[model samples]
Target chain A: MSIIIKSSDDILPSEITDQKVFEGRREFIKKIGFGSAALLTGGHISLSHAKTAAGKYSDLPKSAFSAADKLTDFSDVSGYNNFYEFGTSKYDPAQKAKSFNSDPWSVAIEGEVEKPGVFNLEDFIKPYALEERIYRFRCVEGWSMVIPWVGFPLADMIKQFKPTSKAKYVEFVTLYDTKRMPGQVLKVLPWPYTEGLRIDEAMNPLTLMAVGLYGNDLPNQNGAPIRLVVPWKYGFKSIKSIVKIRFTEHQPLSTWNKIGPKEYGFYSNVNPQVDHPRWSQKTERKIGEPFWAPKHDTQIFNGYAEQVAHLYAGMDLKKNF
Target chain B: MDTVINSNKYSSSLYNPALIKPAVFILCLLPLMNLVWNGFNQGLGVNPAETIIRTLGDWALYILLFTLAVTPLRKIAGLTALIRVRRMLGLIMFFYASLHLLAYVWFDQYFDWNEIVKDIIKRPFITLGFATFILLIPLVLTSTNKMMKRLKRRWKTLHQMIYPISLMAVVHYFWMTRADFRQPVIIAIILSGLLAYRLFVYFKKQQSI
Candidate 1:
């Protein structure tokens, strides 16, 4: 049996262009073929050149994990940040990170892995194809943004390191140069910021080792070169400017958690039901929305519960939070 | 007595209230005007609501400090005419505080009474801030020349609440700040100095008596 798909009526021969015009057009195209070819090819070359010129990963494919929500403005995404290595204020990072050097960076992968080695950032990222994952980034301060982060799954990166059976958790550490990261000079939450994830959480497909955002190299303030992006957790859990990763048998100490154990818990998952000690987490103001706009009702696990809720199966989020 | 009289005469000649009042008034309104202009022009940065709320609170705290500073500044600097703008500055401080509360209520909470009530009850910082604002209401109401004359001796006692109110405001700020207590520390130091000056003057008066 032949399938009969509904189709539009075909164009009649009577509507076709005259032979004289068609032939003349062909002759004209041939006359300008060299210039046109150069123009066409040059345009193609420039377009591709623009992509690489912006960043190595600027032309990445979108992942299925990306959120459908309207992306936050690139200015807002890069401008307003909480990279305490630069400064404590949201705007301070953007201002103070201008002179921050992230070039020739290396990340040491150590601890319970069979292959623990320090690899240059390029070699570390060379194996996987970067993807654009537009995630809803919720801060513990009751604000949020939908960012288009470009990176591959952390699970894929973890597999190459070959974590042993003893690896129950993964720890990530930020660059601790006191001269480069001026904020480290102050005794703010202990220097060399550290964050951790359970092995399963680290291996979750949702976890991203991001290198860029908004089709450009990640701004220095937004964690240049490489950083972790754990969608289900608060922004602080997504450690920035990572210089070290270690697989451990126990939950590693985190900066905020160490500073305020009663306030910032190690499992800093975004749960609206569990309020921060100083502020409510039930609602969050979207970064770029108007001042009069009503705050969005924060979702459990930042609306990634379908993918990650099972991770916290029987655990009480309030107590863990 | 002669020195006080001489200082007053010197201050009155150099610092005319007519020019000083309008100048101080405009200076106080500048922050508000800048905020309004930025609101219209999209100059309040990524988080406009936060900037507006914070700007209002900061100005309120600053003006509160300035209001507190007026007494000590007049006495120490021998600029007795500076007291003419104290009432105006206090009123302006109250105005900013009200706006700060309104911004939090309207923008942050969206006028959700249930959430606001929970915040006031559950959050220590909010409770302190709300209490401070409440304490300011009677002070603002009794600020008028008419109320001052009516209340007479009781008015001085009532307005003394400003000392405690200012301390509570700083504490409220301290509680809300997550880390980097530099700003709060600086504010507290200035506040302590102002309070210390008053205490010193009070004890000196008692000793003389």
Candidate 2:
């Protein structure tokens, strides 16, 4: 079928923001055409933090993800999940996220910020440079998914905030509403699950704000709206359905750490050597592998040691973990 | 629900004895049919052996509970004629229970006698489930009319062992479910209440006698 496509460049931000044209595009009742012109309309293949200024990182040689020989394929991504709000089951997130909607999402940038305001995702993601970085995602349940995340590193985004000395920790909060996120209705977990990282950890170049995954928009089950992507840490630290990003002086109590302090720690860094009390963390079953195939050994820093390991040089991981 | 279970169509009349028995048999097969369908689909992507063992084991305990309920239901429902089918249903419970136990040993643990022995020794849940299976052997062997006649005086006394077996089965299920005990807890409560009712009846009967 011959398809007529509207050029995204000629369309002004004001015209694009106009309700009917954008709403029609958003609803997408008709199929979208991804032709050469569509590609020409500023759809990039590499990294940014929703920056107005593009091509900053393009000057720096792309070395991290360029090492990938192939796009990671899974037999299934179904088994890997991190829905702690639904009682920490591997299947909980997908099963309980029926109420979560990404349609009307506004992230609140608050706490020690001059521009403490809600940012709508529609306009928010439009101007940003989208980059693909294939990173290994390790779940606490001993399973892993190789995800090609499309967003700028967390350092780039946090720099935009211009934090004062008070910004010791970066606290992330999930949007909590029973109507939108039914998992909230499940009183089994404490409400508005939160996770935080030290300001230095958040400023590390490896940390990312995941906008798209697997070369496409993240599915609702995988935390669609805007979520942090901490590669070296356990998968749970990469909080999902995130609405608020706060710069706080005191360390905030994280949901998992509060529920089971012994099992989950505030640092929660990926250390295969340190076993979880209930199960061995030495190795993890790579999804799509045959049942009898041996589990591969997990890495101390999820194999990003060179990039992030130096940040925690003097501290003891065993105690912090 | 009845139509989904059994398609044997006929009018229910007081004189129709033959139609009722086969219809009941078909009704019983619905769960077995679900088991067969799920088994064919590689056990519905669940651990097949675990699924089969748990389902059959739970059902076996349920039917055993139902078999014990026969005397009570007959007393309550006041249907003396229902007595005849209780033995057959009780034996079938033993049959399914045996399969459930066999699946765990054969498929799940792969008949590793050392592991099996260790499991029985270590896990209280496994020990109870295993003990429940062992107790059923004598019941099944003595289910025949000939065995009943041969051990007439002792048969009534020997069959009372099912009470302990039922208790063990409920304990096995209850102990195994660590959290979200929606199904297992319900079964435990029902079995406990039923056994309590039996105790009440036994004491009342003794008092009257």
Give the C-alpha interface root-mean-square deviation per candidate: 0.9, 5.9
The segments of candidate 1 whose C-alpha lies over 4 angstroms from its true place after superposition are: A1-55, B1-14
Report the number of clashing residue pairs per model.
Answer: 0, 3
Q: What is the DockQ of each candidate?
A: 0.69, 0.08
Off by over 4 Å in 2: A1-75, A78-100, A112-116, A122-128, A270-277, A280-285, A289-321, B1-75, B78-209
Model 1: per-residue lDDT, tens digit, B20-51? 67889999999999999999998998899889
Interface RMSD, model 1, angstroms:
0.9
Question: Weakest 10 consecutive residues, lDDT, candidate 2 chain B?
Answer: B3-12
* TM-score to native of every candidate shown: 0.87, 0.62
RMSD of candidate 1 to true structure, Å: 10.3
| Winner by TM-score | 1
True contacts kept of each: 0.86, 0.00
